[model samples]
Target: MAELQEFIDDRPDAREVRKALAVKLVYQGYKYEEIQTILDVSLGSITSWKQAYEEDGISGLRLNHKGKKSYLTAQQREEVLSWLQTKECWELGELEYKLAFEYDVTYESKRSYYDLFDAAGISWKKTTSLNPKADEDAVAAKKKEIETLLARHRQEIEEGKLRVLLLDECHLMWGDLSGYVWGKTDQEIAVRVVNIRDKQTYYGAVDYLEGSLLLKAYNAGNSENTIDYLRYLLDQSPQSKITSFFGDGASYHRSHLVQNFLGEVNQDLSQEEWKIHCVRFAPNCPSQNPIEDIWLQAKTWVRRFCALIPSFSHLKWMFEWFIRHTTFDFATLQMYGAFSEIKY
Candidate 1:
């Protein structure tokens, strides 16, 4: 420990002297945060410096003191870039290992490796979720069918005789309250979870013409709840004679219980004149329903204020409040050619 101060005093290079000083601070029982403020270095760098000094003594604190030089020839750099482009994703350690083994090079700073990634046109990004079972042809055909239906009801919709609602269900868990936020690097941001698996079921519908949202919280998403939600939508739009629902192919949506309720509601009316009509999108293709995006927006809104939520009931209240109050103007609402070919 005493030798670290002597090394810091004797080192000619300012960079090496700084590394030695950080190591000496750690030996003197200084916290990483305090050392960071004192040295203006990151906690990660302080940790690495302490580990390096413990493993290799004073020699480890010296920057590029050994035979190693952080350099690669132009051709070698191009080769590394080519190797990076061969894969869709990578870990930083993989690049470090490749440079150490193949090119016999190592950079003193991680920024150099990041520069290589930039040169290779690679970036850190979040991955999107896609269902492998989705059929493109089926999705296209369903979209076309929906477009034709909307066109046929264009006059009725404009006259307030028919209300087209894109419907979907959301199962939000308490764990969803946890999301990314900027905080100190040395500390972790955590949301206290009483029951991580505690779930809330929500039925959301977006009015096609008005772009207004309707949301209802239910105990569960079963056939009974499905029928009740449909009734709820009807009660909300009493002005519209016909209420049409576009939703996913959930089992409860097509169950006999819901069908029986629909039968009772539209007993005398013809299929075209039915008071309540339900249309299912392509199986496993959630992207076909614009209400899915509305649900996402609602969840994102609640997650933004997750820290203030004290209980799951409060979370549910916030989630429902955001959905019911917000008017959606998302472009996805017009994906089925709404407001263009099929005018309001």
Candidate 2:
């Protein structure tokens, strides 16, 4: 059942109506003791009346005091209500401006304004949805799993002659976007994008632990592209020296083309000197792979400088900017939701 308001003596004549006299006495600039002395009222009576005056506004001052100077004239209240009517959101600072300009009176301070506001019962509020359940336990489990995987992988890296690399991809937009911004306002600083439709995207390959860029390209990250990139690196190097590569579970990375390419590399290379291996990322767990971390760094670099690039002709080349000038030489990579590396 819904709650109903309790009975109140809202009529012009009642205990509350009588209480208004003391309220008016106090509001008219009489101190509690002065009101008590002049009106033959007790100090407690003065206190209750003042409380009601502050809480209920003008109606609370209708106690029929014969003659009392008004602390705040009737006009002052109308002005406050008028100001409130014109604005959608209220800031006390804005109200202070009017007080100082019209009356040459400054609210003592923020504390003073708030103290008065409490009795007025004007509370600030925000809108939010009450979400049910939490995933703290699931998150903790993921953290533990990633930590364990990284430890095991590091041990394999040191114990065996396995060259471990992480693979991933990133989508790069052509121009400025306000999905991120500075300062707190819903207003967006419009930024122009080069090509709003076809935008752009990039694929990357990197060392899992060591900060190194194995390969990069601005193209569809399919199995063919992955194979082609590995072949390009093999052609550039003195020998196809990379042994083990770890990649997130993208369809292209998991396709037969990439598998065949790795198998062929293993067959062609000297068995004693080199052999290629692959590590598939666990389902829905891109953070388990180190390249995911590298991709985030790549995005940070692109976001900060993408506007400087002269034309879309070299949009894909922006990622290499991070490789050359980013503070990655002695970077430490962290594994959690996704692999991430930071210089600090």
Question: Which candidate tops lDDT?
Answer: 1
Segments in model 1 whose C-alpha atoms lie over 4 Å from true places: 1-66, 241-246, 340-344
List, residue by residue over 1-344, the lDDT tens digit for candidate 1: 77988897787988898888888888889987798678766555666677778788888887754533468999999999999989998987688778866876766466788899999999989898788999999999988898988888778877778888888889989988987777899898887789989998888788887898888889898998988899998899877765555566689888999889989998998888788888888888888888888877877888898778999989888888887788889998888666622435
Measured with C-alpha atoms, the lDDT of residue 99 in candidate 1 is: 83
Q: For all candidates, what are the clash counts?
A: 0, 5
lDDT of 2 by residue, 91-131 (tens): 66565555545644433124444543443555576754322
**Which is the leading candidate under TM-score?**
1
Question: lDDT of candidate 2?
Answer: 0.53
Q: What are the models' TM-scores?
A: 0.77, 0.47
Tell me the spans in candidate 2 whose CA falls farther than 4 Å from its real position.
1-161, 175-188, 236-240, 268-274, 306-310, 327-344
